[model samples]
Target: MATLLHIDSSVFPGEASSTRSVADAFRATWEERHPQGTVIYRDLAAHPVPHITADAWSAGYAAAAERTPAQSAAFALRVELMEELERADAVLIGAPMYNFSIPSTLKAWLDNVLLLGRTAGETPSVEGTPTVVVASRGGSYTPGTPREGYEFVQNYLEAVLGGTMGLDVDFIVPELTMAGRNPALSALVPLYEASRERAFGEAVGRAKELAERFAA
Candidate 1:
């Protein structure tokens, strides 16, 4: 059976997070498509991976037999994370914008899985693997928007997931997510609703498209 690596990095739980909810929708569709598929789920907010450390960093370059005890301990986690990414047929990530960028927990997960010679090199092990990202944000960051220049989440992920890691990535963005609750964004509520609906549609369509592609 195919395997999916599903990751969510929202600090908020369940449907409270736009990215998580949209990602959930996509994952639900994907699971329906492959009823017996294996899914490796990681809730980064609740169980954040460790930040890359010197021991872990050094261990990647050292031969297994030469690794020190400290290096072995730290590198074990990175190995597990990397193995998950390598084994997945597809990857789904909920990377909501936080301060114009991705959450620290997500960053940590990336760091753990991104070893230069393995997952981030010229020919990454997971190269061409399909990956979907739900990139929800509080405000609009599309081109021509007031905060367009401030956009970092997509740009950063594109560079990391696509550029460095060589994964085939598609993004489903739900913008202006704070419009419902924030008084300052009240006027944009309609647009936010539209965006949210569009995101869900895209998630479902994309999930089906990718799932079918894999089945063929």
Candidate 2:
């Protein structure tokens, strides 16, 4: 059976989070299609992974047998994270924009898994792995927008997750998510609702397509 690694890095919960809902849509459809498959979930906001330390960095490159006690403990999480990624057939990430970038918790998790020989350095261990990222932004950053180049969540993830790590990434973005809620963005409420609907629709379609494509 195929395995999926579902990760949520949103600080907000429920209706307050667009990314979470989009990812949830994907998970729901995927689970229904593959009832026997396994889905491993990690809520980064609930249980954040620690940032990689100097000792952990050193230990990552060192031989397993050469690691000191401190290094061993520090690098243990990396081992677990790596194993999870390596074992998964697909990876789904719900990463909401935080100040135009991915949440620090997701970044910390990347640091733990994107190692020299484990994830990317030596020919990308998870190359061609289908990874979907539901990236939601409170403000618009599409073409012709004043802050076009300012969008970094999808760009950065595509570069690192696809360009560097060699994962086959597909992004579903819902922009202007705070339109109706945030007073400053109230004028864009109509656009926000439309984008939300389109995003969720695409999320379900893409998830089902992927699940069926990889189902055994």
Candidate 3:
């Protein structure tokens, strides 16, 4: 059976978080399409990966036989994380915007998994794997908007996952998620609902399509 790595970095759960909702729809559809497929899930908000430390960084570049005990343990996790990425036929990331970028937890996971000589070094281990990122933001940042250049989630992810790792990455973003929650964004509630609907719809469709395509 094919393997899928599903990672969610949202601090909030259920209906409160747009990223979670869209990810849930995608996962559900993907499972329906490939019931026997293997799913390796990591909820970063609950069980966040460790940030790369000086020791870990040093260990990552060292020959495996030369790593010290502490470095060995730290580097071991990195190996496991990279192995998951390598084994998966597809990857799904639920990343909510935090301060105009991805959550720290998600960033930490990326740091652990994107190891040199494993994930992208030597040759890209996950090259050509389909990676779907559900990038949810509280406000809109489309072109010409005041926050246009401030949006960094998708761009940064594309640079790392697509540009660097050579993954076939696609993004599904649900913007203006705070419209009904925050008083300042209350006026955009209708637009927020429309955007949410469209995002979820596309997410579900994309999930099924990818699952079907990869099942072959």
Candidate 4:
């Protein structure tokens, strides 16, 4: 059976977080289709991974026989994260926008897993793996929007996950997430609701589509 690596980096739990909610729909649909398949889940908000350190950074460049004890210990966790990424046939990420960027916890996980000679570089191990990112944001940032130039979440991730790691990446954006909470954006609630509905549909559809592409 195929393995799905699902990561939720939103601070809010369950339905409170737009990204998490959309990702949950995707995972539920995937599980329903692949009853016997495996899922490796990580809740980065609840249990944040250690940020990259000097020891961890240095160890990746050192040969097996040259690494010190500290480097070995630091590199162990990085190896574990990378192994999970490598073993997965498909990946699902809940990358909610925060300050026009990704959560720091998600960044930490990316730092640990992005080894130069391993997950990164030409002909990477998981180069062709399918990845779906749920990019939920507080406001609309479409191409024609006033603040479209401020969009960094999708652009940054496209470079890292698609360009650097070589994964085949797709995004399901649920925009205007703050419409219900922000008084100033009350008029845009209708658009936000529509976007949310669209995101859920995309998530479920993408899961089923990917399920058909691989054998158990």
Candidate 5:
């Protein structure tokens, strides 16, 4: 059976936020499809990693090639996060766009997971796996459209998650605030709900197919 890691970085818990709900829905669908598979969850909001400090940066650089005493000590805490991703057959990340960018907490988690020569490197195939990113945004960010100005989040994430790591990145975006006035929001509510369901179902299906093909 495959191992799946489900991560959520949304700070809000209730209806005020949709990231967690979206992630939960995805995890549920995946569980149903892969009954024998193991699913591990990490909530960054409840347990966040401190921002990378000077010491952490120094350790990371010092141990860029091999682990040192200082680097090993600092990296001990991050190893759990890295091991989780490394052992997983697939990864599902749910994050909300904050100020046209990803949350710092999520970025921190990425930094820990995208270790040199581990998750990525100068090698041709840096990433040895596939990942799906489900981004929840309050506005539309389709390029070439009027709201294209707000597309930095998706662009930045794709660059890091796909280009740098060489992971097959798939995205699901549920535009929330773009629906406009109360009446429009009311109309959009059902659409968002339906989109969430479809997105989760599709992700679960894809993950299952991948597991059967690669992990079997």
Candidate 6:
């Protein structure tokens, strides 16, 4: 059976956040499709990874394959997270576009996982697996639209996750377009509700499909 890691970085849970909802839905469907598969979830909100400090950076860049006692202790935390990523056959990330970008917690996790000679190296590995990013935002950021200026989040993520890491990436962004107008907020309540449901359902479907194809 294959192993899957689900990473959720949303601060909010039940309401006012679409990231968690989509992630939960996807997990449920994935479990149903692969009954024997192993699924591990890491909630960044409950246990946030510490940001890279000066000492951590210094140790990481050092040539010591065998680190000092202090460096060994510091690098332990990062190694734990990277091990989880390496063990998984596939990964699912649920992030909300906070202030037109990904949350700092998720960014920190990325920094820890994408280490030199670990996740990537001088020669890229041909065996690198696939990753799916389920993104949620309050505004629209699709291309060729007036609000497309907000599209920096998706582009930046794709470049880092796909281009740099050499992983196949699939993204799903369901926009609640009518929520901006104060007067329309109330009128568009039903639309926002329906959009969330649809987006979550679609994410679940796509995640299951990918899991079956790759994990099989």
Full-model lDDT for every candidate: 0.95, 0.92, 0.90, 0.95, 0.72, 0.76
**Residues 7-59, candidate 6, lDDT per residue (tens digit)?**
99988875446787777777778878778988878889778998876556567
Query: Model 4, range 1-216, lDDT digits (tens) per residue?
Result: 989999999999988999999999999999998999999999999999999999999999999899999999999999999999999999999999999999999999999998877899987888989999999999988999999998999999999999999999999999999999999999999999999999999999999999988763
Superposed Cα deviation of residue 18, candidate 1 (Å)? 0.7
Over 4 Å off in model 5, which ranges? 14-16, 63-70, 124-126, 177-201, 211-215
Clashing pairs for model 2 are none
Error of 1 at 55 (Å): 0.1
lDDT of 3 by residue, 89-204 (tens): 98999989999999999999999888767677547889899989999999999999889999999899999998888899999989998988799999999999899999999999
Write the candidate numbers in order of decreasing lDDT.
Answer: 4, 1, 2, 3, 6, 5
Off by over 4 Å in 1: none
Residue pairs with backbone atoms closer than 3 Å in model 3 (clashes): none
| Model 1 accuracy (lDDT, Cα) | 0.95
Query: What's the TM-score of every candidate structure?
Result: 0.98, 0.97, 0.97, 0.99, 0.81, 0.86
Please give the TM-score that candidate 3 achieves against the real structure. 0.97
lDDT: worst 10-residue window of model 1: 207-216
Report the Cα lDDT for residue 45, model 2. 98
Those runs of model 6 whose alpha carbons end farther than 4 Å from true positions after fitting are 63-66, 121-127, 177-194
- The TM-score of predicted model 4 comes to 0.99
What ordering of candidates by TM-score runs from best to worst?
A: 4, 1, 2, 3, 6, 5
- Please provide the root mean square deviation of candidate 3 (C-alpha atoms, Å): 1.1
Residue 125 lDDT in model 6?
Answer: 43
Supply candidate 5's per-residue lDDT for 130: 69
